[model samples]
Target chain A: MKFGVVTFPGSNGDYDSYAAVRFAMKEKVEFLWHKSEDLQGCDAVILPGGFAHGDYLRAGAIARFSPIMKHVIKFAKSGGIVIGFCNGFQVLTESGLLPGALLRNNHLRFNSKFIYIRVERTDTPFTGVCRKGEVLKIPIAHGEGNYYNFESDVRKLEDNGQVLFRYADASGNASAAANPNGSINNIAGIVSAEGNVLGMMPHPERAVEDIIGSSDGLKVFESVLNYCISPKPVGRL
Target chain B: MTTTAKTKKVIVYVRLKDGVLDPQGVTIQKALGQMGYPDFVSVRSGKFFELEIDAGASDIDRQINEVCSKLLANPVIERFSVEKI
Candidate 1:
């Protein structure tokens, strides 16, 4: 499976994501710079973490207008799985690829730690490998990760099973201790209406290495691989 | 000899309105009080943007207005003011 990791000017996690894909799936992952409009025939794309554009303006404001973003948006609209992590999530939000704005952390500090996130729903392509109620430990580092959307939108997410994951304790119980950023409704991540594009604040790539601690994130990549092998429809619209 | 060029400074502050709950501001105020700055007053936080644009052909006022309205302010709960300092 060909994976494309988009790199913004300040993107730091694209390399880590490349390494993760190589180690787990043994594939020659491609690096798609934010400026390049050409994707070079990638099956899926990932927007990795880091302070894109030095996080100037807003976290993902400038990066959302990158030339490649137009292609990424179309790719996602065509039923491609465009998963965004950390800063990537911000970009998706800014570009209207995802809903909800990420406000400053409720704690008013940068959070960097492995926190438990329960699989709130698995009906999407990104979370199909994860079982509902399964809790995975993922590290998050960001000041603006508090997700806030209109109450109607939040309810729609819950009703449609678009809320894929929530911060929860290791035992799979959801609570403030598990919710790192005090995101509204404790939402750690969510998917688009079609369940193809997902934007989440947690870093799943960092959790793929066993020696680092728990590799619960492998489940996410594994789910992607399974999706790749599965007979995906021809091309995106 | 060529003359040096200079641009005016623009200050834009975005703050939560009255009656709005600003958890970040509250936390900072609490922390300040805890640090023994008992005299510290209320702290309502917002964004400060310094924009330097080529005011040659474009309308500076229009550009600045677009920047503030479209990007700087969320327009839902936040208010902003821009001044040339």
Candidate 2:
């Protein structure tokens, strides 16, 4: 399946995402400029990490107004697969494609480190390759990765199985020490109610190869690719 | 007939909603307490924006509201108040 990686102004990780797809995964990939209002017939789209639009007013706030986002919004509404990583996740929330908001870290410090995230559910395309409660070592680099939502919305997300990944220890326990950003409920990643879109703070693209450290991040991309190649029936015909 | 449009200033104040955690505010409070200002109860951090728009802009209220909701503040975690002066 072909993948489209968005390149918003100031997006530094677009190349990393493109490289991961083209070289590491050996898949067809294209770069979608922020001003282009086209998807280019790609199967899935990736909004990579970085301070888009210099993260001026707020992270992802200005980037949301990019012309390409209009197409992205429509694509996601039609059940298209979209993954927003780090700053991209902030964009997803700012665009109202995802729920909740990312806030300043509780410690008010920028954290850049390798962390563990336990797969909360393996049903969605993003986490299909992960075993139940499996932990993957990924690196997170952000200052406003703390996720906040109303109590009711949080409960709704939990009930709907929208909570996809949580900060966890090496043993898969959701502990405070494992949560580098102080996100509510230790949430590191989550999906929309329909499970078509995913927003996460961790940078999986950075951990796609064993030479760097671990290849666990590859599972996420592979899962999406496999799903796209062999889609399941949504309902009786 | 001729018409002249005047520029007006709009101020928008944005703050985290009740119960939302404010780490920056907490740190400032800590510093204040350590600096011998223990009587202060609490501190909350917020932001404001000053917008200069033409007074004759169509639907000025609606436009300002849209700006607040779409760009100035995130509705999920923040609440904003806009005032014209």
Which candidate ranks first by TM-score, i.e. highest?
2
Model 2 regions more than 4 Å off: A233-237, B1-5
Q: Write the per-residue lDDT of candidate 2 for residues A51-98, one digit (tens) a residue.
A: 999999889999999999999999999999999999999999999999
lDDT of 1 by residue, A179-218 (tens): 8887878899988877788889999989987788678888
Q: What is the lDDT of candidate 1?
A: 0.82
State the DockQ of every prediction: 0.31, 0.86
Root mean square deviation (Cα) for candidate 1: 4.0
Q: Count clashes in each candidate, considering only residues at least 3 apart in sequence or on different chains.
A: 0, 0
Off by over 4 Å in 1: A231-237, B1-11, B16-23, B31-42, B50-62, B74-85
Clashes of 2: 0
Top candidate on DockQ is 2
TM-score of each: 0.85, 0.96
